[model samples]
Target: MDTTDDARTRIDTTVAHPARRYNYWLGGKDHFAADRASGDAIAAAMPGVKLMAVENRAFMGRAVRYLAEQGIRQFLDIGTGIPAPNNTHEIAQSVDPSSRVVYVDNDPIVLTHARALLTSAPGGANAYIDGDLRDPEAILAHPDLPATLDLSRPVALLLVAVLHFIREDEHPERIIETLTAALAPGSYLVASHATWEYLPAEVIAALTRNNTDGRFQARTAARFAELLAPFDLVEPGIESVAYWHADDVPGPRPSAEEVACFGAVARIR
Candidate 1:
C-alpha cells in the first residue's frame, strides 16, 4: 500500500497499539478507546505501570542529553512511539541546537503523526521514516536518514522500550550487532526493555494476558544484558530505568517497583 493507504489499513483503532497505549500512559490525547482500555487494564494489573512509562521518558531525556554532551549530534531513534514531550530530538537539540535526528517506526499511526517530531532548530534537522526495527537495513538506507544524519560521524542509536516486541526467534542480539556495526566508532547504542524478572507473578500473568498482539515477550535481566554485549556499556551499566544516571528533578522520583524497565547506554567501539 501507498503511504496514505498504508496508514489507513494499518492504524487499527479497534485494538491498542503499544505507541497509543504508551501515549495514553503519558496523558497524550492521541489514543482510542481500545488503547485506553488496554492501558488501563495493564495499569490495574501492574500498579506501577504509569510510573514506569514516565520513568522511561525521563531516562530517554537523560540518555539523549548525555550523548549530546559527549559531542554526539546525530541520532537514529527506532521504535519511536507517538510523539511526546521531551522527545529525543527535543532533548538532543536543547543541548546542541545543531543536532540532527531521524525517527523510524513500523506503526503507520506513528507515521501519520511523524511530522509532530520533525520540527527542529534552524541549523538542525529532523526526519521520519515508516520503517521497522526488525529491518535495520531499511532504516539505515532510508533516503531521509542519510539526508538528515551523517552516519559516518558519531550517532546515537536509540531503541528504548521497544525491543521487547522482538521475539527471541527474531534473533534480537544479532539484529543489535548488525545495527551497531554499521554506526561509526564512538557512536552510542541506547536501549530500555521491560522484564518479568522485576515484576510479581500475578502482575506478569495479567500483563501477558493483556498483551493483545503477543508482541512483547518479557525476558530476564540476563537476556537484556546480552543485548548490549557487543558494545561497551557506559558507567552505571544496565541499571533500573529510574536509576539510570537519574538526576533529582523537581518532581518525585519513581519507586523501585515503579521501574520495571532496564536502561543502558553503550558505545559502538
Candidate 2:
C-alpha cells in the first residue's frame, strides 16, 4: 500500500497508542477517547504520572540544547511522538540554524503530522520516517536519515521517555548497541527512562495492576545504565529529569520519587 493508505489503515482510534496517550498526558489535543482512558487509568494508579511526562519533556529540551551548544548539529530522535512545542529539531535548530534532525516513530498519527516535525530553520533540515524502535537497522537504513544526517560525523541519539515502553523481551540492549555502533566516535546518546526505584510498594503494585496492556516496564538506575553499554556518561549522570541541567527551571524542583524518571547524556567511547 502507499504511505497514505498505510497510515490510514494503521490508525485505529479504538485502540490506545503510546504516542496518543503521551500526547494526552502532555495536554495535547490530538489524542482520542481510548488514549485518554489509558492515560487516566495510569494516572489513577500514579497520581504524579502527568508530572513525570512534563518533566521528561523538559529533560529532552535541556539535553538537545546542551548537545547543540557542544557543536553537535545532527540529531536522531527515535520514538518521536505527536508534534509538540520545543521538539528536538526546534531546540537544536534554535542553537544552530543549520542543525539537521531525523525523527523516527511507528505511530500513524505521527506519520500524518510529519510535516509539522519537518519545519526546519532556513539553513537546517528535518525529516520524519515511519519506523519502530525495535528495529534500529531499518531506521538507520531509511533514505531520509542518510540524506539528512551524515553518519560519519557526530550525531546525538535522543531516546527520551521511550525506552520503558520497550519490554525486556525486545532486547533493548541489542537495539541500543546497534544504533550506537552506527554513530561516530564523538557522537552522544541522550536518554531518559521511567524507574520504579523511588515509588512506594503500594504505588508500584497499583501501577503494575493498572498496566494491563504491559506497555510500561520501569527500570532501576543501574539497569538503565547497563542498557547504554560502553558509552561514558557525562557529568551529573543518571539524574531525575526534573534536575537534569534544570538550573534555569525555577526554584523548588520536584523530588526523584515524584518525577519517577532518570535522564542522562553519554559520549560514544
Candidate 3:
C-alpha cells in the first residue's frame, strides 16, 4: 500500500466518488456527506439501489468461489472498491489457502484501506496495485502482479460492478481483450455489469445525472455479454447478479428487480 500523503491528497471529499458511494450503500461509514447525498439521490430515484450493491458483492463472492472450485489459484482483481467482507482473496483462499491474488484500483481511498484487503493464508500471496482499468497494459505490467501471480497458470480476472463507469468510447472490450490475451487458455473472466433492462428510460436518465462526472453507463444484457465473447461462458450465463449462482448465494436472496446488474463467469478457450 502506498499510503503516501500525496496519493491521499488526490481524493476529493467535496465530490462524490463511486467507490465511496458504493461503500455508503453497503452500510459502511467510510463515506462523507457528498457521497451520502449522491447515494441517497440515486436510491430515491430508483428504489432498492442499496440492494443492488449488496447483490453485486454477493455475485463477486459466488464467482470467486466458483473459480476456486475449478482449481484456479491466481487472481487479478481490478476495480476493487473499498475493502469489504468476502473479498476475492478471502473467498479464493478459503477454498485453497495457496491461492494468490493481486488487487488493482486507482482509488486512493481504496489504497488507503489496502492493508485490510491484502491478507493471505499461510500458502498464499496477496498484493495491491494502484492502477485503473482504462489502462490494461499498465495493469498487466504492474511489477507486483507477476510476483504474486504466475502468468503461465490459470488465473481468474474479476471485474465486478466496475465497467459501467467506463463509457463506450473508452473501448472496454479492447481493454478486456488486452488483459485476456495476457492470460493462458484455461484462465477465467468473471464480470458483473450494471444494466438498464428493468428500468424505465426516465429512471435511467435520472441515475445518469446522479452519478458524478456524467459517467455510469448501463448497458443491455446482450451488450454486457459481448464483453466476454472471446471466452466460453460458464453455466447460468449473463443472468442477473442475484441469480448467477443462486445455490452458492448465502442468506435470503435479493429479487431480480433489486439487482440491475448482469453477472457471468467465462473461461478462455
Top model by lDDT, which number?
2
- lDDT per residue as tens, model 1, 68-106: 999999999998898988988899989989999999887
lDDT of 3: 0.88
lDDT of 2 by residue, 244-268 (tens): 9998898799989898999999999
Give the Cα lDDT of each candidate: 0.86, 0.92, 0.88
Candidate 1: worst-modelled 10 consecutive residues by lDDT? 248-257
Off by over 4 Å in 2: none
- Give the C-alpha miss distance for residue 33 in model 1, angstroms: 1.5
Q: Rank the candidates by TM-score, best first.
A: 2, 3, 1
The estimated TM-scores of all candidates read 0.94, 0.97, 0.95
Give the alpha carbon lDDT tens digit for every residue of 27-109 in model 3.
Answer: 99889999999999999888878889988998899889888998999999999989988889999999999999999988888
Off by over 4 Å in 3: 248-252
